[model samples]
Target: MHSILPLLGATSLAGASVLQQALINPTNQVLFGSYDSKPLVSSEALEAQITEKNLRKRAEDLFSIAQEGVEEYNHPTRLTLCHTGHLATINYIYATIAELDDYYEISNQTFDAVVGNVFEYRLVLGDRQPDSVLAMSLTPPTPDKEAVFGPLVLVANDGCNESDFPATIKGAIALIKRGVCGFGDKSALAGKAGAIAAVVYNNENGSVSGTLGTPSKYHVASFGISNEDAQPLIKKLEAGDVIPSSAYMDAIVQKTGTTNIMAQTKGGDQENCVMLGGHSDSVAEGPGINDDGTGSLTLLEVATHLADYKVNNCVRFAWWAGEEEGLLGSDYYVSQLSKEENLKIRLFMDYDMMASPNYAYQVYNATDAANPVGSEELRNLYTNYYEAHGQNWTYIPFDGRSDYDAFIKNGIPGGGIATGAEGVKSENEVAMFGGKAGEWYDHCYHQLCDDLDNLAYDAWVMNTKLVAHSVATYAVSFKGFPKRTDVKMNDVSEPSIYHGPKLIM
Candidate 1:
């Protein structure tokens, strides 16, 4: 219900005039009926509105927002849930939608979220601080005057078990290998064995970084180091060298308030709405232009263009927050909805990382019987659009990896698409998508280099158009769409399958 008056002046008079006409007078009531009357928004027309130029403009805007935070916060990264960059991101999306208030009802849904912040972190071995040290998420912040100092004891196995820590681990910093268990388990086990802190080294190439899952009474401060950085330390330790190490960490995890921006078309069926969303916040590593900036902007661009015509079913867009920390915003939104409100939503679509440099047109495969009934229909909508356009696509699981988790768990049919993230491309995928087979789909998935240059413009545009086509199609009719069923809430005790920084195990 909140509106920003300044945004009204930002709209073009011609576009506003056309919007007025489209909403007040139309020909086809069966296909499209507005609050008043207007022409039905066609798939071709909506798709035509999605352009590379528009996408890049918004991408650049988002990148600058994150960059501004880097300069303001004087930190390596400040775009996550605990940073000012995220606040700015929320404001940006809100303003964009507020500008088109005439066509949509915009609101800010605020909620309390558990967010973490890292002020200072370091791990020094024998007077040398390695560049590969990364502070694990949810690690308890260090006191201002305290820094851990002791022998770096190499734990047996992955340090997932209490017995993995040797007798000498008392008052030491345990060095464990990353695998076999969650980081939280390793750190907790190390603490239980009398270690002050724990450091996990990567099992594979590249630097390791992840959450300890959540704050726990048993967990101690934890850090992740790269494989290369740990090899020499391990060799020296095995040679009976007491490698003196010092660790300093200053961070905190606490409850804070954040907002979810939502916009629904004023013209479509309010009783049977089509919803779509993407997380607006990035990780602490980088600006995350492709990680979700692509998804957020895609929603923005489509919503902007969608204002020009009427629809049969209401279309709603959401810019979710704190997805990297976990699915906080989306989950909060879903939790607040009444049973009637939940049933009002016909289906929900999610878009995340739409433009990986080494991309693939991967649609969410909602074929699992566990998925909500009609979830497959939502999947087919995107596949049909791709197939009609001669675009090659593959299937990815609806494993509750994104914001769709909340909706699907509530028995609302959910589906969407993503390019790829962190997953290595196969030779067959290279044959279809034409990228380096062994390399990550996005080398800069969660790194300092995930800037504007990281996006694949071609892939982004294709996916954006696909989004437009789907939105237009759903908005026009639900002829073949299934009716909402009384589905019981999914088991709450099951572990999360989201690909957020948290370890799945």
Candidate 2:
């Protein structure tokens, strides 16, 4: 068993002594026997163990960790890759798993990854300055430490086409709406039109953040602003006002190291393992309580309850880092694995954004040809569970947006659930799940307001129960489950255009 001493190093001697007493109990000691000693856990029993109180406590803890980062950095943070809050989050998960040292093997997988670090970003329009502006990735910052200043020019449509920029737009800054194309495309179009810089504003209520997919010579310094902040400037430009604007962004894309936390049951069949995970890091916008905190904590909570019983197949839980920066951590882990190691993983399940304010029980639709052979079975597991519970469910496509991208591409079956993000709730969805129509499923998705108040408790608990049910079912048997065949690496081509939620390109 790994030592928990490191976690208690900062505690008072008396508190340390008490914890030591609690850990030394005979039941907590590792047994040197075979796997037959403990009885197998059932889905119903495991699901019963999940509670709203425990889930909320962990959510509160994550929220507090984000707040601590805010205090330490004196600004908002999303537990960005290898940052203070992110490291703290890794420590918290490690410590929690260390407490159950007798039942699981815990380790940290560290690897190199590229992440964008923003030092300073500012957007000025006339006398008004927006409080939040997200710097688009893979684009160069302003040159010579100078802001790109010019007269604001509103694009014809979404700035996806060359025709959107008039010939008179030279030396001006193009103001584009969020929909209809990739941020990179918009910036490239604006730059080709001789615009100095580009600003993409959200069409919805909250702030927006995205990437340019890859480096492009035609791309200019670009940033994303909120609807509230961009509406006034948009109206002014439409009303024939020559609004003066300036955009300055100081950021860098560099290679850095981060850790992925993994814990697996010691007694289950090691050759055929069931793996599940969620990204631990968040964007730089807010605490990311809902963006991924809910997913990470759900895995943690389920792992805690799982420690009490045995399983037929080894169950591994991962809290991945650098997911926000394009599935960096999970991709790196997959890349390092040998074919034998990859085959040992019978299936990989991912849970992200389990709780959205205007929640919909959406499961990953694994019927896409790109998905592995066994993906359909994995999808059925989740859908069947929801049906048995008399719950209304929908299907979401495998858009290669989350951690599951790596597993699916490697021909390993992958599927899971998410409430929603940035996507508007349809009236049909509203009738199924009670929330306002046309509003975002997670109004606070990747925003400053995604704190504890952002979570939907009822939905969180329901999805967490489903998580436990899946774990319990898969751990006991893969009786009818499809066998994983030798993996034929798929065409790992990058998407033509990359943007968040809705695709304009």
Write down the worst ten-residue block by lDDT for model 2: 10-19
Tens-digit per-residue lDDT, 1-505, candidate 1? 2343332222122112222322211232222223455568888878876778778778877776776566545533435453467776776776676666478888787788887766678888777887898888778755452798899999998887777889999899999998878888888888888888888999998778778766777667788989999999999999999988888888878877777888988777899898999998887778888989999989988887787678889999998888887788898898888888888888899999999999999998886366777788888888888899888999986776789888888878889999999889999999988999999999998887899789999999999989988899889998988888564533222455344645533
Candidate 2 local lDDT, 1-505, one digit each (tens): 1222332222122111212222211244533244466557788877777778777778877776676566545654545553667776777777777776467888778777767656687888787777667777655677665787888889987888999898867888788888766787888888889988888888888877777655567878888889998988888888898998888878766667778888889878998899999988887768888989999999988887777678999999998888887787788788878998898888899999999999999999986356677788888888898899889999987777788877877778888999999889999998888899999999998778888899999999999999988899889999988787787643233452332232323
Residue 480 alpha-carbon offset, candidate 1, angstroms = 2.9
Q: In model 2, what is the error at residue 67, expressed in angstroms?
A: 2.0
Q: Which ten residues in a row have the lowest lDDT in candidate 1?
A: 9-18
Residue 254's lDDT within candidate 1 is 82
RMSD of each: 5.3, 5.7
lDDT of 2: 0.78
Per model, how many backbone clashes are there?
1, 2
Estimate TM-scores for all models: 0.81, 0.78
Runs off by more than 4 Å, candidate 1: 1-35, 75-83, 119-134, 142-147, 152-170, 175-182, 200-208, 225-245, 489-504
TM-score of 2: 0.78
